[model samples]
Target: MEVLVSEVVGRGTVLAGRYRVLSPVVSDLAGASAWQATDQILDRPVRVRILEHGAVAPALDAARRAALVTDARLVRVLDVGTHEGYGYVVSEQLVGQSLARLVAQGPLTADQARAVVGEAASALEIARRRGVHHLALRPSVLHVSPDGRVLLGGLALDAALLGDSGGDARSTTRADAVGLVRLLYAALTGLWPADPRAPQTPGGETLPPAPIVNGSPVAPADLVPGVPNDLDTLCVVTLGPNEDGPHSPGELVRELEPWGEIRASVAETATLGEPMTAQFPPTGAAAPGGGIPVPADHDDQDTAPVTVQRQSVRTAFAQQDPPGANRPGTPPPATPTRATGLGPVPSDAETPPTGLPLITPPAYTQAAPPPPVVRRPVAQATAPPPPPEEETLEAFGFNDVIGAETAAPTTRRFDPTALILILVAVAVIIGVVLAFRALFASFDTGASSDTDPDPAPSASAPAVADPAPEPTAAETPVAPAGGPPVIASTTSIDPSDADGEHQEDVAKAYDGDPATFWYTQTYKRDDFAGFKDAVGYAITLTQKTTVSTVTLRTNSTGGNVEVRATDAANPTAGPVLASGAFGPETVLTLEPATETQSLVLWITQLPPAPEGGFRVEVTEIALS
Candidate 1:
């Protein structure tokens, strides 16, 4: 049942003036009606997810926020609005199958699992940074693009439509993070880790839920063989890692990035997708009555003189090995820009393939190796050229010689002793070459003693440690010598307002999310009405990182804020590092930079809110 205030719209029903519903009706996760529809306005296909009218606010806000995530692997949200009493979100349609349909057949190969889940994790992590959470990330919401790219759908709107995201920001973050690891487990073992007894899993119901014991999911390795130790540990540890808790999506991406397309899965191609070219062949493929011209009898058809017959494109590609793919130390051959030997089509390939039209490819010539230059005797004016049969030894030997031709036998041109001198000179030259070769052979055999490989290192040898894995580029600053502050956590502080609950929201300001914000309590006056001097939030860094500047992006302009170096999550007092009035963006600089584990952002004065009270909403906070 749709949230239609009027009559139910079936197939071919137009909604929101342009979308013509094509899918009859489908229900899942959100208790919503989903349809495949054609956008008459754009003249293209689109996916429309329709929910009840009550979910309009959250779903619309979530869709708008999710639209700000600019990753190619994320499905684009085209429209979000109300039609009649129903709220709907329209997104781009995918031509390829979803991971649900793919996994329905069988478990994916390890490479496919990693790539699909890895790319999904990457996109969701990017979405998380934008203050949008796909609390419902799972196989069904993940799709394979036509080019094999795995894309994530329903970034924020899914959870909104499902009504599963009423938790605070921290809980929502953890839910999304844990959801990513669970997806990895499901992709690997074909068993979903989310509790089976729950009404629904993230991204809706798909695979059979994993077996549970004592409130915990079973490890994937217990069911699957050859699952890598690292991946297995990643899946299991997140269920319970350490005191630090479940792993975040950023953490998952670090582990998953290296194994991209780790192994080939071409054997599952038929189950994965239909060969796109077979359904619609290339241009000129369906010519009538042998219309394609045969280049065999053409004058320029002789590409190059060759002793061997040329193979068809298919046969040549089958034999071509990837560089360093097979035997080691063998040099790779040159790959051609275009395939050759398509001239008249082979005698064995005259018939078109069944159901597929033959594509008569354009004719092209292959480059040939150049002939070697040779020195030959020149014919004299008085003499005829030497007979072709006795011409010269140039064709048979690697030697070059010059001489003149004559009509008759001439008197000896030089003394016979000259030949003897020439022989002596050749012998001396050969002896010198042999002597150098013997010398180099002695050097090659004799040079080894400085650093012996067999001996173990002494106890005093300096320890060599493995390099730490590099985090994704977004998390780390570009130049670390004196760069951005690496913040660890945040909390709001208001000693005067004892009942004020702001812990969950202090994080939103500096969370790298552009949509969320941290705001102060509304006061009747522009300044706190004869209350405490200020109310603000504090930032705890990963370590004692230096800070040269603090930047903020806020919805409320002209409000006053101060930066303070402090150790308190709930600071009562601290030394001011910098102070300034807020604009659309505000930057506060500290001379010579300060190194510390925690810093505070104290808001003293508030800007007037649109309705009545004075308040401030800081969208983002940055350190550099």
Candidate 2:
């Protein structure tokens, strides 16, 4: 049953009992269609994915489940169920347009691209924290909303299906990062890596060349013009072939420091210290009674201590004194008489001029004893030998006090043993110095010997001895006259061939300008176990003109199918183009703008129907 865009719009009902269809968003060749819908339970807008009737249900289910566990950046799934023999999935509705669409509109400015990179890095960080790896990341899968929010969606779980689950999860993330680097490179340079001998489609068909212009590779600065050399280096380093590029999103975010702002408030807080109310501050309204005051000036006088006696005297004077009782209208107490050391009675005569007190002397008595001494006969004691006269060091030509000699200077006579030891030390030092000199000399000699004396002669010897033979005009191969025009192709499958093998599956040529032709293919295969039983086909195009652009399109006969573009000569050249779910039909346009001799098309894993094999067909090819 071929489903027309009109028919899908006509069938207005709840899909899978969860999503109520609103309008068709897009459809691709894998028979997968996206529709705007409202979730019954959540009451939120969601996108519904409806697989073709004969597509593999289990594989789709597996993918949905893996997405739920793997990536936080993916749109959340609300429900999954079958309706009218077709599988449908309810997912969160994104409010954004694909990055591809943005690029098509216009290349992003440097600042705009940087902002997008930050958002993408943040999203990837979230995924990394959750241990989810997005195996599929392309411009088409990356979306930017009207409000400038970036979202990443569409995860591929083919490896998970094959059970090669070891460190592949990490590898998958790195691979996706590399792919993003390539995409960024392409965006910057408008060229891709060269592939001249790529493989063709599984059938005898060939695909056009990639859309890359010229044979030039992209430079980081070209994509985001005016980027600093350091930033460019960082991008290259992060996207380099190192196994430890960045294991987590946080690490990746660190490389984007150029975009982060320096928070002034945070810096001020750090400098001023923590809030005063937090466990510590001043304890008084102004200065505490006994507490030290903060100095207003840098002088020590402000905080210096005064003598205690002076302080006490000042305090005593400050106290109030009692009134005197001796004279009328006068204070009773003045200065204390005891303190003045004056008598209590008043003197009748004039007081002495001095303010000192008069004192009386007391009489004293003493007893003395006297003793008589007899003359002693003193034998003349011989005076000890005159003590040796002190000889001052100064007398000996030295200062005595400053340089006193504690002992006599004894002449040190060198013994035979000491003399031999001295000689041995001198010999050892001489030997060591000579040995080091010889060692260094040898090292220098060896280094010089290793280097060729005439480097130029040695380098040019082979080239000069055996020069390349000059080519004769007759022996040189000349290109065909009027050289082939570049070929371009764009394909979008039709609903009629939704479940049948595409006509373009077989090798074919077109009568167009051979410069601008679009090619399409469709296929249907029943009995697929969601993983196996894939539909395989090839497209071959003769070199009527040098092919430039090659577009591979796919639509599911029943369910959605994954599409990948690779070198037709070598299938492992790695997919140059890849995407998820070509619903009814999706177009992949390649325009290399260079001469391509031939091209091949390849398709695989067609959705299987219970009744019979699904069908697919290619619709158009444009060459110039």
Candidate 3:
């Protein structure tokens, strides 16, 4: 009979007799459905995979069983059993988005992309050590949890059973690395790789490749403009060769250490069950037997009761069997023993029943009483041993251990008096050195002062000795402009070879074409001390052909400033349409002129100079 919603399986409708099924997480092609279940035993939430009746059921069961034996970083199978002809495997529920989602959003910042891949590398390293390989590390299979925990899904146990895949570990690791590299490339460049011969998915639809340039995977720098070279190198190295790269997850962790503090806060917040408002279809939310109402929000407090009940059930199972539990009346599986030596295998006469004596061969064999094998209780067996003494220093190499000991003296036996004396001596030495440095500095300062040039008089300074009689000239005033015209003024300057010549101090020089200087002063800065009084400066330009437009703008207060320009050029003399004060940064458009040369701009009026003399620098100009 098909199970219906709210139907209790085991103690409750949860896996391992702990979880309470709230709703379906996802339903797969097989009748198996993934559900969002609360752990009644642990008071936590988990995902339960309910298998449907199919040919793959037995195979999946075996895979799930095998999964329990390894140390792989693959998803942990919490419980597995057959209920009403339908098998289910309950595993940990990961709260995160798929790598595919992150890729689809857009290219990640260099740091973000590195972190994502670095995490995957760690998971892969763990799998490698445990002799398990995740054959599927595609964007779809890798999940970046909301808490930034990277979870790998879709193990290859079943695949191994189906084929003579001798290269399970190697192939999986290689493919995973390759796929991670591809994902990183996409994240950094917003482009896919260019592999023309690469086979497409079974349907003939091509998968996205790494970002490409000229038929080769493009460097991260080529894809994203202004990506740091170091970051680019990291991406390349990460994707280069797995064997030669980070040896293990620990090494990968070290490699990623240089990235500024990871934003683990996001992960922490996620772990605390912060509500996510953005609506996306729930993952792993399908019921196997019948209609079940999955909790819409995993973070909801109301779900705690269900989780508590699930935890109770889990606790009961734990007390019953525990992991590796061997119950009374159940014979432990026989362990295989191999005997190695010279002569033909001895018969029952030479070989002791248990085979312990055959390997050593006692001088005078007396039938030893059957050695009683003492088995620890399952609960005690599962408990970990006490941590070794000096645990902190163990992970570091011996050299590091010794170095740390020598460098950091133990304070327990230290003499305060002696330490104080030593500190005093050091302080005396430091003081002497500082005193000498101060003396020399003072001397140098005096010397510099003696050699310093006389300061120029301020513009408001009184004339010394009646500054030579003012020269008489015809008084010319255009409309008798007063107080700077109450000048709500804006200056628009176009970049050109002529402007380059007249403004050599401000224009950036280029080696390719001396006349074609790149616009370097696109950002506005308040540090332009000379242009304090100026209101604003707008640059206008037009490019005739496709060319990279370079601009450098600056303003006062070193506030927001942007350079804006069009890819095409204009023919008119007044291409500049408007100019405004930069409350924040302001982007002004410059249309290239049809005159073959990209227009150069100089805006001198916005920031008025003191004494009518202002200095605004526009260094470096280029069109390509």
Candidate 4:
């Protein structure tokens, strides 16, 4: 039902009796135009939005909703009417620039962006609670008044009314939250991260989508490097495909208010020179032997060797000195440059021209040196000497007085001491095993004594006695040994007896499938009703039978309930047999109790669901 107009209205046109167009401000490709006009009746300035022919109904509906929101961050909607062949809405003229113009100049600082978006979130929360959604929110529609108030425009109202939202109220709210976050990101980075499903802005200029990693969009801090981590996470959770957090504007506002109040700079500081690897303490102005200068403190000078840097080692070795040299000013005896672990030292010609005292090797020594080095034979002695093991036993201080034949055979045989130790170990293991067997025998005797004694046989061992009276409902069933217990089939008890809808779903509780569950309808209060505190189901067997135990599996946590057995037509009329609080799963072993036809599971209390509802879900049930 779209209306087409043959003529276009221009400047100086009169509309709805007295309003006169003074100037055309902006005309969008979407067939919506804004004009600066004068209210001839009131003699004051006003802003007007001209809508295409068939758009009048939705435009007026949105204008009415937008008019109810009174916030400094939102533009004020005044009136809605049509003149000639066109429809339009009027509002107070705002004196400021659009968010697009502000961003075009340059990106806003982090604090500025926070303040702006925080204000927008507060305004959006108001509209959200009233069920009004701005699905067409974009930078071009967000204006900042001259007095520093944020004004969000409503180019989205018409689009939402036209059924272009493609989603429900909750989904539209999600989109609006995402849109605000996108605007914040654009303000902070000067780049728009568009959503493909969102409506196009007035101009038709397109923006690239945010970068995706794995399956989700990358965080803002990763893209720009200086965005605060908290802000980045907020944006990702609100706008990314995997988002499952805070789906409303109020929740978003709570997360952003603290960020706006923070005053610290978020920009990363730059390093002017080469990247730092490691830093060494600065050297003093002077040193002995022209080596790296050492600190003047007496304690540090004495301990310098332990804390000495590698740079000092090279300079120290270059100036040769004897093992125990004197202080810097004192002369010492001539000494050769010993072969330090750092290889050969420089010759006198290679030394610096500066005349300085010779270096004294510090007394702090490392680990003991290896065995004296042996120079290889000059004629290429490739054949290695026999191993040290081949030497005679005397080389290792072993006895040598005995004859060679006896000594050689004795040394080759196993030691008598090791043989004795192995025999002792075997004896110990046998003793331990025998002790374990003895202990097991004692335990078996104790267990046999604790078991019930078998019924004594009649002294005469004659004819069988008369048959006992038939068991009645008062008698409990005796379970046979070495057999699995029988399970009973379950059915949904009076569903209408509880909160109204989905009562038939309770049958799933005994379906034996964890994937399917029975749930109670959500109630305003935790208790199901004023008269009764519980809701439940019944399990009935084909014939009268005994149930030794029952198990209930619930997906929820924290609630009290009772299980009972009854022969009456209704299970709730039975006497309680077991009672306890609920967990992931509950198992109750019934004590000696009367036989019954039906079992009842009644929930006497309730807990809140994760999202502000009160209900209970049971996944499966078992009886033994």
- Top candidate, metric lDDT: 1
Would you list the clashing residue pairs of candidate 4? none
Tell me each candidate's TM-score. Answer: 0.42, 0.34, 0.37, 0.40
Residue 346 accuracy (lDDT) in model 3: 53
Count clashing residue pairs per candidate: 0, 86, 78, 0
Model 1 is weakest, by summed lDDT over 10 consecutive residues, at: 275-284
lDDT of 3 by residue, 319-343 (tens): 3345555643335643433345432
Q: Quote the RMSD, in angstroms, for model 4.
A: 33.8
Q: Residue 606's C-alpha lDDT in candidate 4?
A: 68
- Per-residue lDDT tens digits for candidate 1, residues 1-624, read 643532555577788899888863334564566777889988988877777645668888888887766666788888877776667888877545566656555455554576667767767666666577888767777767555566678788877876765477776777776777777787766677774433474444477777776666777667665566667877777765342434456666556643323222332343211311111011112124733211122222123221211121222233434444633223443332334353443434444444244444444333453444444444433545545544554455522533333324344576779899999999778666666654454434332335644332554432223222343443365655534568788877664433232455777887788899987766556656544567778788887788889988988877788888875544635577788998779999975578877888877788888777688888998888
Per-residue lDDT of candidate 4, residues 394-503 (tens digit):
35544334343433322345569988999999977966666665445433422222243643254333212322233444344776433333445554443233222245
Question: How many residue pairs of model 3 clash at the backbone?
Answer: 78
User: Which rank order by lDDT, best down to worst?
Assistant: 1, 4, 3, 2
The TM-score-based order of candidates, best leading, equals 1, 4, 3, 2
Model 2's alpha-carbon lDDT is 0.41
Whole-model lDDT for model 4 versus the true structure? 0.59
Task: For candidate 2, write residues 247-323 as lDDT tens digits.
Answer: 55445544442231111111112111111111111111213562222213223321332211111111222231333
Off-target runs (Cα >4 Å) in candidate 1 are: 2-6, 166-168, 196-205, 241-246, 262-624
lDDT of each: 0.63, 0.41, 0.43, 0.59
Clashing residue pairs, backbone N/CA/C < 3 A, model 1:
none
Give the poorly placed runs of model 3, Cα more than 4 Å off.
Answer: 1-19, 26-32, 53-74, 145-148, 157-168, 189-218, 228-261, 264-624
